[model samples]
Target: MEELLQQLAGKLGIATRFSDGGLVRKDYEVDDAVVRYIAERLGYKAGNRGEVEKSLADFEKRRWQQTLENIYVVEQGKLQFDAVVPAEQAQSFFALQIENKDTGIRSEVAFEVHPTDETYTIGKTIYVKLLVAITNELPVGYYNLTFTVADKTYKSTLAVAPCRCYENPALADGKIWGYALQLYSLRSERNWGVGDFTDLGNFIRMCARCGADIIGLNPLNVLVHSFPENASPYSSISRLFLNPIYIDVEAVPEFKPEDLSEIADKIAELRQSELIDYAEVYPLKISVLEKLYGRFMADRGSDRRNEFRAFVEAQGDDLHKLALFQTLYDIKSTYIWGGWTAWEDEFQNPNSPAVRKFAEEYADRIRFFKYLQFEADRQFKQASAVVAECGLKVGLYRDLAVGVGKDSAELWSDNDLFIRDVGAGAPPDAFFPAGQKWCLGAFNPYVLKERCYEPFIKILRANMNAAGALRIDHVMGLMRLYIIPDNGDAGTYVMYNFKDMLNIVAIESCRNKCQIVGESIGNVPEGFLETLAEKNIYALSVLWAERKDAGWGDFNAPGEYPEKAFMSVGTHDMAPLRMWWFGYDIELMHSLGLMDEAAKNDTYHKREIDRWKLLSALDANGCWPEDNLRKDNYIYGQGYPEGIEEAVHRFAAKTASKVFLAQLEDILHVEKMQNLPGTDKEHPNWRRKLPVTLEKLEGDIAYIRNIQAIRRER
Candidate 1:
């Protein structure tokens, strides 16, 4: 039974044992309950020994019967693959036709198969291996391959990809410096309340004028529109679309703020609030969006109307799914049903007749949602244009979140693409001792292969659109995910086809002309970083995580950093330099009840040591002020050190990395973290607004001097 369980789990991509985040290999004992649940999910028999054995035999038979996989990823110059065929057809000629999906060009080649000794038998029929080589050279792109062997037709997707992801030619000239910040955190006097695409454009103009090459942004993926307070960009409703809330309502054609003047006082109050009230902001923006949408529908000009139509047509089914999902959520909100999972079975199924009727009834309302996306896309393109206009090498480096929310529109649209019951998260690590259950869904590896990775390809294309670069959050997910089943206590690992996924990423990167950055921060598997570097996918190196011990200890000096990396002072999850140097994060965690008295005491002690070590490292790198090593500064830990923030920025800028990004919060010495990983509502995670407005930030003497110092250091 144990052996059978192992075989079944292996076939299902479930790791029998895995290396944890701590770099310790732990054997996962086969749990009967876990195995049973997984088997049932994968449509395998786990009732008894006899049934399990039979299921295994059937799976093996099916595997051997298939002549070709659903897809194959090959290098641009290597188009050779192995195929299985009936023994009698081994010596027959095979006709292969490859059609480029983009160009609609087809190439034909006839090749005689070279049979190998490897053979498999099912009943009376025998299958033999054939080495099929194509002489026709194909460029880097996706192609539809049709193979005919003795009148038998076999179809598969052939992805010819570059050996490595796209690397910006500017990098070869010299390393570049940039700023990373959450777009929503921007405080702009002109914005309605929350930061919008217009704010992004203003920021680009400011940073580009400062000689910046890139601007890193938090994920702009769409979230729950009605329940906007669930505002973790990392846990979005759909990665395929942009957040409409970030749309500049005033920028929308035909918008008239005076027409809605009654809410002027409310908008003023929201704009002045320190933390964003997404609940208030979402409704306000939606109200204005609805008005603009209505006006456009009533009196849009031919050119503009045709543009919207073209966008809708270009977006096609994905746009339809997103709009339909939003429309259904709007209607379901009347009853306040728990989620799509709790909806009536008829409504839950996207293709059900009942859903079709609901969609037809709310077709106009659905169009309203599509209009929002269109405006958001248009504004994003406008903002991205500023990168070139300002002479920035890489403008608007967008982020792609690791996974979608559990009950998101993405899950509602396609059930087979994801494993609904199991949740994706991280294993226990130094950052979070209890581990984390992200409450996010994991994609089914089997389903991805079956679909020729169409879902993944679409997601990359969507996020890569209108961007100079894309950062893949928790990029280890391309190799494996920590999947915790609903019925299991501790989750296990599920491996993916890493090479194939990387190849596809490379192909998309070249196609979009966008560089790739992989955030492989925690619990990364062995050789993962090296593989990413080899593929030219820049590694994300957080200053806090670059210590010699990989913990709170001595830091790796500036010159020791990787050349092919995007280094930063810290990430959104970590405290800014000011907060870290003062042990404010520990105090905040304790105050929020995330840490006990004992843990807080220990953490504070460690933080003091970390601070001292950080100063020492900076001093050694010649980035720290001469007075920072004074006895008074180290002994009292009183009155925030003035030059430390600049010193930290200097330290990061001097790293060997090809790209260095200073967090806006760190540069401005903001004490609050953009996100506190463990807490949700308990802490103001993603709601904190920047202290200064865009106009003030650009003109502030201190900010300008800091940028100048960084420029000189780099």
Candidate 2:
């Protein structure tokens, strides 16, 4: 396996070794057959050894050709033009011109060392400086550079970057607090079935009244809701647009009681269920949206019509493409397409003549989707405005899911930017021994560079446009991603130019004046956090995940947490505080077949010890009465105990971390987690609702106490 893997590794440009400590190299273990399978999967044809070797050589040549494209992207400033002058042609000269791709603004830049300069050396690369442009004249954005070196002309990219990323003044104070919530799980009477912007706005007021400064939400990325069962927000279709599911139809200005009378009862029935009925809610919401659209088009006054027109114009090609994609998706899924990849060729080609005709024929439907995104943005903006009006410092901190599924609108629209056949995920780690395959397509590094990273920039801008902050989920993807060949379960790492990516984040964050937080959890590579910290991006410190400084490696103390971190008792992926404390999650995992009997028993034993350690720490800190930690009370009892959740939250709040987030599950003391990482139909992920509605939270004793406890600790 080793010799075969090594042989195939070089042929495929994949590393067969990795380093964890020192500079020592280690051999990897990918079966030779596996690489052969991947090579064929990527459309390489070879029946014999010689043919396979030839194909591998051809692949390497293609990679080299792409690398030598001569496109260089530099931060905005004095443009530098570099060229080589032969010793015989030392007196040759060149001219440099930079033009803004979007704005059509052009400038002439001088080279640092011209060919006629006394110091210019023949056969040496000489750097020519272009005169620096005024910052006001040249805004922070992408530009095109055209260089003329004798008979040769070359084109490249020049991007202007802001000094540093934005960090909200309030969050920088080292003691602001927030509520972390899975937005869908929030129950409210005003929304259709799942939580909506209306609920978020109302909750913002409640949070402010309770002295909270920020409200963290789960990823709002658009999910493939046509198939309601797999509704993991992380596994979304498009991050560039908002999810239509979050639209509050009743809150629309054009919504009239008569318009939705036919479906009012269905909406009511949806709210009555404990678990969110996504299947029912999707169709009902669409019906309401259609009615609203009809009402909108009935009286398209110049003022309103122009507003929608301006939005469509500003959103540009991306929005129009997304609309067409959604329109075709709805049509084909409802009528023609059956299994995956069964869609016709024209459907696969987003810009085909047949597709263009279908789009023209279904223009109204396309506009409907476009309006859905506009409305979603409008309501979200209104919610953020409310937060600002209520005197909150940092509000609506949104999470950006790491990547999108392989078969998604974004990938379909911009297929070249994403790699197909292979899925992106994690390598082997403590929590996931076999590694994880997220079944998501990764951004093709080569295409991103060739395209000047417009796709990623668009995604970042869309996410940061309305929120006070952005939390990048699985933040490590910016650095390197694990790609599983042929969508299989295990994979190897693919490196990216993360430094430049981080710089872009800084530029966007500064432009928006929003702080950034990276979810740097579980098995992060060394120097990853340092890289994030250097960019002034905050870190997350899940209390349970932080290991003790000494002894048996129990949970760490709040004081030990970093000042640049957001301290939390638990995250959405893990069990709620009470569930973890009571061992309910472990038992649930066993029941769900996630663990065997032996593993369950061993886990429970470890859980008991960790519980004891937690109690001792809490007792030592005077968070709870020491009498609660008596040996007699520490037996095989793993039931929910009074005040433990609050104490756990208090421990988190007391951390030196600047931002402390109290999750909704801990506030409600819910046993079930919002998501089970690797499950689909086996659990009700993202479908669980709060035990009580938003209205009830204002008066519930336990809820109120939890709020006060967090505030007091903060």
Candidate 3:
């Protein structure tokens, strides 16, 4: 029991003090001594003791609960707390509160649309009016009135009606407005082996030519290091900043000089390649950037400096702190996770005068990081503007990850709002028996509400600022999160509150006029889809995950799909259709040596079932030869067993989803997936380069026509 308590305390980063009677204090108090002790234990420098004590005193005053239940136990030389909320208390705690007149003045205004006074008709259009009644005088201020539908925003004219009510105009159905593309892969000319902004521009042009209204890409979120080999945009260091790696250094106005001939030549060499090689491209780009920075510094102008300073100022203090953290990170190298809790005694106590003085001294270094972010934003916006010039309706749709990294800037800056001792992850399912531990720290539910949901609002505003649409990865997390306590196994975790979460999502989606696509996959609660639909959030339909059971029907069939959903054949996680069909990539298994006896048997059984299904489908379609000799030939063919391509197209085109996305890999006949989940080393994830360069892809007439045909059929 003592050992278990010690392990739990270590994992939670809290010190446990034991008394002679076997009673223990977890030291939930935050103070200089505690902070310094933790920092020293975590291997960070300590600054001053006096400041730490003051900060800790203030922190302890804040209302905090270390346990869900008011109960404690002691055994041997250790103590345990019942942190789990009891059923009786849970019911009362999680119950919804009803609005009352005494508590707050409230009124409900309904907007109704009526074509011919017959509202029940499906084809009839309706106009609605809003009515508001006030019992007391409201604050005088400018209030923005906006309306959103299916992620599209529009403003309604406000008029002082006869009875504080006004009727607005009605909108027609089936109007051909511009549709935004919500999923896109970036393309680059000099992307080590992957696509970049240059490729994105070219792809946007192609999309424009094909009558695509918008092109959405994965998150371009900033990372802590240039070489961590992280491909997920959702797992970023700072949500407010941009990834400098995506910056087009050549596009800078100062780079057009003739003396930069060598840099231009390097871009040319990279453009000729079909794949992106990040290892090679990152170093070369950084070296050229250093040279450019040197040149700019040597001939620095007052105007440029002022502009940079203004950019730094606009980011505000939180961003400055993040920048300072980054600089400290770079200097210490190994202290990537050394946040305030792990810093030296003086620094650990945020209220310390010494820490404040240190921040003042390193202010310039922090400003430099902010300047870098400002430049990145300026360049990316310019790139998007170019795409808009090409007549694309929605230029960029950004992705938002389900959660933040445990040691990210957001967690450090807002530690009180985040529960570091509990991590978010998926529960066990058919796909992964052991479940998944994402190593992400989620926001504390109680704290988030007490703070008026400020954290969520900030994230939403930041992400929507430069995006046409937003895809919430694992969108179900917004409703309920599976939380595993520190040092606890997956089975011991409990579900957190989700009612308030739904309201927050609705408010944000309504506020941001940007369309929302919920990646609603796996273990979703009953009626969750219905609720999302009610909130006007679109559903995502992945072709590979669709089923043809009687209840679910054939998702590939247009009539069977949901009208408000988006359809795609495969995502970055799955193997390309061709590879899944061929089963040629066994190197991943051999390299990782993860294929033990049990795994080998599981793989064999899974593959055999898939093979049988494929053969059955072909036979049912009448594509198989009737004659024994011809049947054998068809089965032994080098390419696909015939009719598979047509089936795939038919499956996608027939979906009832309003929008369909075709992967460039499938169009170009690429055989491997961009990423393989689960194994870090075994999976050659996020490293595969496109088979053809952006230039060559632009010229692929057959590939272009094939996609055009599919779109036309749809």
Candidate 4:
């Protein structure tokens, strides 16, 4: 029974063990209950030994009977694939035809199958290596493959991609620096409470004036519009679409600022608050948008109307599906209550009769939702255009979140691709001892491969079209994911076809002329960083994580940093530089009951030492401010001297890295983190607004001086 379970697990792509960053391997013994639960979810009867044996035999038979995979993706320099053929048919001639996806050009080759020495008894099959070496045959693009054997014809997709991702040409001149900020955190006098597309355009122009080439942003994926208070850009409803809330309502052609007289007082109140009140902001914007949408709908023969129609047609089914999902969600929340999970079984499937009926009845509402996306897309592009106009090199760097929420619209639209009832998360480590479950859906590796990665490709193309570069959050998921089943405790890792995934990324990167950066921060697997470097994917290097020795106080000098990396002082998940230097996070964690007294005391002691060591490292790297004191004379409670934050940013800028980034919070000397990882509503995560508005920031001496120093150092 145990042997049968092992065979089944192997076929399902579940890892029996995994090694940590330290190269210490730990094996997960086959647990009967966990195995049975996961198997049942995957549509297998694993209740008893006899059923398990049948499942294993069936899986093996299906795999052995297959002649070739549905899709074959290979790198440019290496082009080869294996074919499973009957021993008697091994000597037969096979005809191969390849047609380019973009161009209608076609090529053909004829060859005999050269079988390997080994043979499988399941179907009396032999492995044959079919090396495709044609004179100028395949380039870095997708192709339609046709293979013929005797009278039978088989079809599959062939993707020949570059081995490495696209490299920005600006890097050859010199290193470039940028500022990373949450878009909603930006404050402008003209905005309706929260930051909008107009603010983004203005901010981009301001950064360019300081000679910064890049502007990194938090994920702008669509979230639950009905419950706007449930805000966290990372936990989005649909990654393939843009968030409509970021649209600049007043900037719309049909919008009139004088029309907002009824809600003028509400907008002013929201802008005055220290934090963004999303609940109020969402409704206020919608009320004004509905008025503008009405005006737009009335303009029958206008060019803008035709443009919207053309956009709808170009977006096709993906836009329609998202609009439908949002419309359904709105009705469900109003009457049925809860998310899509609470809907009737007939309405669960997008193609079901009930859903079709609902979509038809509410077609106008769905069209309204689509209009929201249209405006959002239009504004986002306008903001992105500001990058080039301002002479920035690598402009508008966007972020792609790791996964979607469990009850996300993505799951509702296509349930088969997601492994329902399972979650993707981190294993127990130094910080999270009990382990963490993010409550996000894990992708079914089998389904993704079977679908020829169409879903994944669509997501890449969507985000890549709007930015000069894209940062994939938790890029390690391309290799393996720590999956925890709903019924199990800490679960095991599930491996993926990482090589094929990276090849696809390369194809998309080159096609869009966008560079790629992988966030490889915590609990990294062995050789992962090296693999990222080889593939031309920049690995993330946090300032705090770049230590030279065992002691936390010993930091790496600027020269020690890797050239192929995205260097930053901190991320949205960690404390800002000012907070880290002051040990404010330690105090906050202790007050939140996340750390005990002993742990708090020990962490504070180390933090004090780290403060001094950081200054010493900066001084060694020629980044320390002349007026700052680095010795013991600098007291903890007395606060850091002027230009301390700028010096920290300058330290990162002086690194050997090609791309250096400073958080906007750090540049403005904000002490709070944009988010605390574990806590959701307990801590005000993703709600804090920038203390300084864009109008003031444009002329603020400290802001200009801080950004200029980074530009100079780079």
Candidate 5:
């Protein structure tokens, strides 16, 4: 079993990799069931010893010829492969499909490989090198490489990227101050049940005045509109587009505030809510937006219409496909349905005649969908401009989710680029013992290259536009992803060409003049940080995770944090700073039944010790918040400690890290966390609203003090 497993692992490149931290190999279950699962995932199976031997033999015969990922440098290219056929029959002609992404000039450049008179033996394959010079200029973007040899076409991809990321001007000092927030959770006097770009604009202006360089946000990508209850910012419906729910209806050009006398009633009703009622907000906003779209269209003046036209044209087939998908989806499902999968077969294919007929018949409806995106873009761009005018450096920090839901516009539009049968997930990291299935179908590396990463580039450009910095959630996904088969309980790791991916990220970052920050946490692969550093991307540093000793791990010195990191006290998935300080997370987890009896007790014991170390660090900086109780008094049995919130703020602020980001929850000391991972309906995920209104937040004394503390640390 061991010998067979090793043989399979070597052939499939499915060996164990990465850790929850910088060290420790990730745990993988390789039982008979798991072995079979891996075999099935890799397109092989062994029923008995005799069959296993035959399968092993077959795998060895074709292992070299099967190219999972074909990688090459920009312009200068190399093609290496193992061929089972006669070397003389390998007459290779490389056809490079280059798209000048910036200018939109696409042309095919073909050339022959050098020294084609090469035959291959059974044991070894031949290598071919090519200087792929183009007659036309090509942008630093992904391209398609097609190689034809012996009457067969070998499909591959060409990824073009610069050496490093954008030269960040904000790196003058080692420290920067920022505030992290979930945009939808924000409450404002003007918002309609949820925070809009208008609220974000105001927040940006206020944060700038309070000496903040950036304002981090949850993923602003589009979530399920028809299925509002499935509102998770991290698990989005589409990562390529902005959410229309966040659009400020009042900001539209056709919006007539005076004429909205009747609609004003619903707006006020939504604003009065504590938790975001997505159901109410969806209908109310969509109805209003449809009215706005009608009004805007009635005025046949093509100036705004021309802008919309340019946007559609610039967006290419994607915008049209998304608009059509939404139109078709609305026609099929409504109110509570989760996805667009149940639609007609003709509608399923974006290019089908049924789709064309539906699109033309419901042209106005489709335009309304396009108009919604346009308004979102306009308001978001305006808010970003406000960030700059208000003098914030990395003004509106954006988040890019790791992947999208299986039934998403992204997958629907670009079905060829993803592995549809399986979902992407993480192996058992230190946190999730059973591992985590994100329920997202990520891009297939081979197909991603085959398609020249067209969908990927669009997703990146859309996110980078109108933002100062982009935070790539689960950035480790670029290096490798655990792909779970539909038939398997255990998943196998599939490596990505991160060298090319990083290069592409660098190119996009530089093009947008935005800094790239990667959210890499829990069982990181060895040298992943170095890869990010090579691309000049920043890392995420959570206060609770950073420890002193490698043994049990205590808090380390603030000055010892990563030079290029966004230092923060808490993450959305974890307990807030106040909860950590009081050891309430343990109690909360206990109540939630997240841990076993032994695990719970052990966690509580370790947290108590870590709490003391945290307090001592706060005391050393003279930032301890207790009115009378100090660290010494607490360690030596004080009566009680209070006001530790202020101490926690200052603790993160004093870090010599590149950035100190204080979440609005921690700044205002909101007791409840934004999310609790591994639990869905048990907790109110992505629906919590801010305790204070945006208007009140600007003038809040405590909030002001917290921001000032962070700035002082910077």
Candidate 6:
């Protein structure tokens, strides 16, 4: 026991104390063993000794609890787990390694591998070969292997021998070959007040027509069934599973005609509404789904049941544990921000036998949760396939939020990884005078470095597997995060190391084969854009933000913007061009305190003149005669006159950016912003539904032609 403690202490590079009372390194002394262990884990050879030593020394000096916050170090092709330790306790350790004798070198580590073939048939066994390079020689022994691929986990064994190749044929192609992202309310039809898989599949078919290769969706991570307030997908209760709300109740095999009729009136009520009311829809859908589940159980030998079982098995123990946790969470009704340490002593210790026994007792509930995820995955894949059949190049580019909720599954499962005391947010910037304090907990820098960034890799794979392209919200976070210390004000925070973070991001991007779009909109550090460019990650160019000055202007000129970017007029957070032009109410703006009376008057007058000039130019083109223009219709509101949508689109089309994204709202001529910043219930945010249904949207000739024209020119 003393020897084991010494070895661990040496490897951890910290002073070790055995149960019998023995110490390896002094409390304040540098732990060489721990440093060596970290260095080896990071794949740095003797050549990097000096740098590793320096880093260890720095770690000791900086006693910040959140040391390895968001740092990613991939060694031997695998992300290293965080190796946090007191600087004085740095030390060295050894890992059993397997080398390839044929090459007389270490085998390459395998992070992830994708199928070379673009398409495959269902029920066909396919073999995919992976190459891994090991960094050290190891004693002959057997090792257990655990890997997650395509939302499925596979565990196996590898015998220590000289081998360069690791082949996995078990991960063969399935019936669903594509991935789709839920556009949420962006879809046209069959959305029971909110976008569901039905609408997603229809959109996928449209993508097929457009020649799109793959589709990606936002994190479909599950949320509590009853909570409609938490709209962000990243703040999920379980990262290992899927959100049940996305389930297409009618599509379930067990759904009966009579059950459907029972909910017909409720369903009809939902169809008439535009915005998604999850509180109402979720309950109604769940009631119908429960009925379906009963039928599914009755027909045990059915194909759907078998599929569900396979999915449950594939997800393994993780899903079961999370589901149980969710059940517990609901029953206890604990506050999200309340520290987990405060949970009843029995519930707090996740690994205790008692908890395990409890989880087993509630196995049925766990299975149900797993069943929902499996179905959601199936529907999402089918939707993606529909998109691939379309003609779009990148079918569904999903967005990944910067961090998860503090009380999320990630925090619960890996409490040590996140700093519960501190919150992650943005520093004071021009857009926001007060530093933003997002409630999400950030990974401790020190802890992350000690662990070698395994958590980040998990997140990356989750988003990458099903995406053709990924929009990293607040891409600048990869470089530096503003971490507000626990028990501190929003302004009390520090920055994390940037270079290390970028390296991991670059590697992940290469491995995924998915285009990366960094949302580098605000408070960007110097040379950050250049760095992202060098890494082959594209930038996000908003038409509103592309002007030479902060004021709005014609920004589509080629020389003005980066060529490799996704150009958009506005996003979900901003007002639609039409709304900004025609409906900028001064009273509302004043009430929101966006501007003072004097400043508002001056700005309003300047914008009115600018609108007149633009309208005059349009009238000169004879598109609309000067006399034909109705003064009332063209009246200036807060900023611009009506009829600015055409100009905005034209400007966006002409930009140097390779990809152009016309907001669904703009296309449908929606008047309201999907969400408003600063205020929540005061405004109708994420709740507004699209005015037109999916069927109507498809038949909207004008809308189709306009988008087609833009794409044609691109």
Over 238-331, each residue of candidate 3 has an lDDT whose tens digit, in order, gives 7767777676666654454563576666666665554445566666765766565555556667577677668777777767767766665555
Off by over 4 Å in 2: 1-13, 19-27, 32-91, 97-141, 162-164, 335-340, 487-490, 549-552
Best by lDDT: 1
Best by TM-score: 1
Query: How high is each candidate's TM-score?
Result: 0.97, 0.88, 0.69, 0.96, 0.85, 0.72
Q: lDDT of all predictions, in order shown? A: 0.85, 0.75, 0.53, 0.83, 0.73, 0.57
- CA lDDT of 84 in candidate 5? 33
- Per-residue C-alpha lDDT of model 5 across residues 591-653, encoded as one tens digit per residue: 888877788778877766776787777777677745544555654223235556666777788
Give lDDT tens digits, candidate 4, residues 1-714: 377777777777775555444324443454566667677666666788899888887776666577777888888766666666667777676788888889989888543355677556664445443433433446799888887777778888888889899988987567888888799999988888888889999999988887888988999999999999889998888888998889988888889869877878888899889999999999888888888889999999999999999999998888898899999888888888768888989888999999999999999889889899889989989998898789899998889998999878888898989887788888766677657898888778778888888889988988887688899999999988888888766776777789988999999999998989999765787788889889999878888888876435478888888888888988898998788877899999888888899999999888777777887887777777556764575535456767877778778888999899888788887889889878877789999898999989968777888877886787
Q: What is the lDDT of candidate 3?
A: 0.53
Q: After superposition, how far is residue 4 of candidate 3 from its true place, in Å?
A: 23
Report the error of model 1 at residue 695, Å: 0.6
Question: Against the hidden true structure, what lDDT does model 1 obtain?
Answer: 0.85
Off-target runs (Cα >4 Å) in candidate 6 are 1-182, 186-189, 208-219, 238-240, 298-306, 334-345, 492-497, 550-559, 583-589, 592-603, 609-635, 638-644
Ranking by lDDT: 1, 4, 2, 5, 6, 3
Error of 2 at 634 (Å): 4.3
lDDT for 378 (candidate 1):
96
Residue 140 in model 3: lDDT: 18
What is candidate 2's lDDT per residue for 368-476, written digit by digit as tens? 9998988898888887788879988888889999998876888888876776678887666545667787878888776687677878888998898778889998898
Worst 10 residues of 1 by lDDT: 23-32
User: What is the lDDT, from 0 to 100, of the residue 29 in candidate 6?
Assistant: 24
Please give the lDDT score for candidate 4. Answer: 0.83
Better structure of 1 and 5 per TM-score = 1
